[model samples]
Target: MTAIAPALVPLLVTLPLLGAAIALIAGRHRRVQITVSVATLTVVCAIAATLLTVVDLGDQAIAVSVGGWPIPFGIVLYVDRLAALLVMVSSVVLLAVLLFSVGQGAVDNDDDTPVSIFHPSYLILAAGIFNAFIAGDLFNLYVGFEILLVASYVLITLGSTESRIRTGVVYIVVSLVSSILFLSAIAVIYGALGTVNIVQISQRMGDLDQDTQLVMHLLLLLAFAIKAAVFPLSFWLPDSYPTAPAPVTAVFAGLLTKVGVYAIIRTETELFLFNDVNVLLMVAAMATMIVGVLGAVAQAELKRILSFTLVSHIGYMLFGLAIATPAAIGATIYYMVHHIVVQTTLFLAVGLVERRAGSTSILRVKGLMKAAPLIAVLYFIPAVNLGGLPPFSGFIGKFALFDAAAEEGDPLMIALIVAGVVTSLLTLYALMRAWNLSFWREEDDSAETEARISYLGDAPAASVSTERRVIPRIMTSATVGMVGLTVALTVFAGPLYDICARIGGALLEPVTIGQLEQEHEQSTGGDDKGEER
Candidate 1:
């Protein structure tokens, strides 16, 4: 809570990057590479968690002006309760993925899995996410974006197998175009307002005509929309995400797009101010929910279906922002965190499913109950949670969100709320269909057993029978870990929800964000106030 405590922001972002550099240089020494990378992330998470605690102590935002200079001139690292909370949540998620990615008995690298640069690439990706969450300026955030984008490029293409490479190409092109759009948006904001600091832009945007502000705001939202995979701009998601390795795809589904949502939340509440964009954002949220779930229903592949669900869930976050009330946004925060874990765990479970079934295509995979009952449980928990089952965090989060909306008394919001319920139901039905087909039937090895290889399971040893079994340790382990996290979320629901409320409060009124901008402007003494460079 003290000045010294808040300064951990830079180190949190920098340390993992430092380790990533070490990994890239010493990649051949796999042991050292993994050790350094994991240590760095562990420390980063610790610092971030500490910061979150300090923020909970009500010290407001913890900001350190880098280089000992004030905001605008030197980079500022700001950690609000919201940023700190996300940093912590994301850190845990990424860490879990790291555990599964780097630990022994994970990944089939020795056999057929190629391009497993799980060490260097994963660390850098975590670093970028940290930087993005805490960055105090738009350009600083841009740097974070690039860092993650580049790392993701590597992660997606790792092993460079033909299919992986193909997915990587789609990812690269879409990402490049999004980056360009982001840069252009930033340029426009900088050119129009003479400042790239998000807080300053928010403060000054009111000076411009409403039309100009609208255009600029829409452009900025456009960039995040693309990244977040909102409908119409979401074509890139399903094409590329489901094709990557399961761990990579799980992390992407869980973290990458959510980062974009985080950005939009920051922009709407702190920069462009979504106060007046209610109608548009509300409509967009409804459309995103409907379209996304529709796509999910139509998908035949396990990962692809989850990917569609990922896009559909983005709508919930947007709904919170659109509603812009403390209660609604608070619930949105809870929803965001809940969805991240649920989605990530579900995707990881699918990985387990793929291991046991030898395929991810729903049509090709069947009889998981007969072939691997553990995979059935692995698949079911998250599916049930996603359906908003009670005793799970998903229900708590959605209940809060709906409660907030119901109090609004707007017929439109009421309708949107109905749409949300329908979406959740349809999502459940979709998952159920897949579950029934995969887990209910027998190993129709009423044909050939070897012909039905369990690609989703670990390579079998001579001792492990190739028969239909209800439990697989590896599959069970992944499912248990996931279920454990969800249960923790449920048990700690009050405290976690409290943290989210604080985050919503801090984000809604970003005074520290403003202070940083003011500090920057005073440090620069307005010599560079010209609109254009």
Candidate 2:
């Protein structure tokens, strides 16, 4: 099992890239494109699950050197428990979102997500995400980011609508700026330490002067902070996400920023384990939580409101990172998985709402309770779950995070706990408010609804009503599956969280290049002895 796991690491990335190529070539055959994309992700999902089991049972990480190159010189793909788990969850999300897009395309005749362009780009995006998760070095991670940027640019600008193109431009520019900063940091690190390999860099980072180390740390943090949509760096997200198609929006909200957060976790725990930036991160987390939810409360459109909440919930993850403890880190992982699924489910449900009604504006859409009870139910479950209601995965994750922080008993940790609770309440208010106005009230009561929410003050001007479309069964099925997965996070929280706790503990224990080399030798020597027998 140990021998085989390393070989599977590269396939996690290559299979998706191969599928994207095949999908692109089969442009004229929509069924062929769909089959290849679906099969690829399903297989990747299986591989990730296998790796997760292998790593967990063996209690060792698998690091593969691409092209058989030695450590610190070749491209390395590392699959520890965290990488494997995220890949598996991300693949599940990717597959579900693809099905949702397929249903939308069938119903709308590819008007929103041109099938030929969407399939290949979507697969490429999957490849990028998987690559980033497993990448064992900084340069490889940057390549993953670039791959995401290119594919997402195409996906976001699909249909070439003016609003999409405008948003895509802002997204592209922001992404490019972040990339440049990341690249610059890589250059500085490579120059200083003479290596960009993560384990090797971690081993060497302590050798640098305090000033140099601080500079390098902040550069990488700034780059990833922008990507994770951390406060003061998150302004672009709310404007950029809502303009994309539903599947595009859902996947972007679910997976993209989490990738950034994952990078930050790696940066903080693996690369600069001893860095004293926790205070700075805690302050940022507080601001991110409060400011982001404030933005959400001010929004009248469902998509924009959800986008702001997405940014708000990110602070919870940052708060965990700021705590810099193993338990906090473990809880952050759980919260990340929770937020990804629940947030994506909410967006997909809103997609259904948009199709059922002509608009997503709370003031404009009404009577969904009787008109579309299914959509109402679909929207309500994830809304409250995201709001951090009890027994839901969202609440479980937040409680775990708070419990971890309480162990520290620091004043800032306590303050962040308060901010997090307040943020959760505000998130619920924003989502349920939209729910009540959009679903419970009658169309004839629009005047009353407006009168009641008039304190929000004319923000509905940004919302535009379009012709109502038929809701597709497959889209709803995909969303229902996601919601079920969210519930499963709660039902099976015990075992799954144990795995995350172990991962968190393992993450803080730094591994050196020597350790990887030793493992490589042992595996090769064992294989040779078996061949002789």
Candidate 3:
């Protein structure tokens, strides 16, 4: 079992792609599509969970080389605790979102059903996400990004509606520019190091001049920052995401930017273990937090508001990464897990709100608390949780981050800590404001505005109970399931944090950073000795 564990790693990436092909072939039959998608994700999730347990318990990394080639020569899929844990959590989110989409598709009329293209593209997107999490080399990571981008382009503009087209154009342009920057960085790194393997690059990074190192670092970071939607570079996110379908927006808001954050974590802790740019990263983190929350405050739309807060909360992760201590990095990992679940849940719930209330824009929708109590509960739990209320995963994650930062005990770190607090308070204020307008306040005729609505079958509700019954069981159940996962994060904080702390401690070790390089050299040396014999 132990010897075969590493070989099982590729199944996480391959199963989803296989599922995508089958989903494409079966798209004409909704039942077939649903069955394939759910089964594929369930199996992938199990595989990811098993990988995480094996890696964590074994206290070792799993590296699978394709075509029987040794490290640096063939494509590799590597899974350490961090990568495996991320893949597992991501698979959970992917599964939940897929279920939510299936529910949405089920209730719609034949004419109202989502295009047949959604399933294949959605599964392909899952494959890309899984690939990125386990990618062992820089070039493979780039391939993962490309795969997802192509799928996202289709998902984002599913209807080919005027608004989606306009927004998709902007999104593709921004993504292309970022991709170009990433490709150029890869070229530079390859020119310098002769290999794009992450471990090899980390080992050889020291040999480069300071100027070359900084240039390579900044170029790669610029690309990732755009993808991560870091402030200044992040202006593209709020606009681009809101126009996509609810599930599309939910996954994009929750998972895509974090992939960029994941890259930044890898770059800082693993590749540049000895050399870091904490000051610059801290400044970016501060700005991302403050600016993102303020933007959330200004939005009158639920989706747009969540989108901004999504950007803001990313700063917390950056804060942990910038501190770079074991505790700080550990908190960062925990925070990522919290934020992904909560953010995705909020979006899923809001999607239901749009279905029942006739809009996501707070100015147009009203009285959901009375009209759809279940929907209200769905939104309220995540809303408060996201606002950093006590006894919730969000608060636990934030408190851990603040505690980690305080230990650093520097004035700059202290100031960022204060900013984090303010951001938390303001995030609560913004979410509550939207909640009050959308769910609590009575519908005022004078305040009403044009709403972008995509309600299924039913006309606008005449009473609270009527709207309550309108919600599909599957959609509500999926949202509730995600909310439960968020609760689990708080409930399981001890063991989860221990895992994150172990990962952080390992990342901080210089020897751990060069594990791949050391393995490569030892293997090569052994091969040469055998050849001589």
What's model 1's lDDT at 378?
71
TM-scores, all candidates, are: 0.88, 0.97, 0.92
Q: Which stretches of candidate 2 lie over 4 Å from their true place?
A: 460-462, 521-533
Task: Give the runs in model 1 whose Cα sits over 4 Å from its true position.
Answer: 1-3, 103-107, 110-116, 444-479, 512-514, 517-533
Q: Candidate 3 lDDT, tens digit per residue, 81-131?
A: 999999999999999988888777776642223737888888899899989
| lDDT for each residue of candidate 1 in 325-371, tens digit (9 for 90 to 100) | 88888899899989988999998888777666667666567677866
- Order the candidate numbers by TM-score, best to worst: 2, 3, 1
TM-score of 2: 0.97
Please list all clashing residue pairs in model 2, or write none if there are none: none
- What is the C-alpha lDDT profile of model 2 across 1-533, one tens digit per residue? 66677778889989999999999999999999999999999999999999999889988787777876666588888888999999999999999999999999999999999999999999999999999999999999999999999999999999999999998999999999999999999999999999999999999999998889899999999999999999999989998898899999999999999999999999999999987599999999999999999999998899999999999999999999998889999999989989989999999999998888988888778899999998899899999999999999899989999999999999989999999999999999999988998888887784665777877656743457778998788999999998888889889989989998998898889998877765555544444333223
The pairs that clash in candidate 3 are none
- The whole-model lDDT of each prediction reads 0.76, 0.91, 0.83
Ranking by lDDT: 2, 3, 1
- Please count the clashing residue pairs in each candidate, in the order shown: 11, 0, 0
**Candidate 1 CA-lDDT value:** 0.76
Q: What is the lDDT of residue 326 in candidate 2?
A: 91
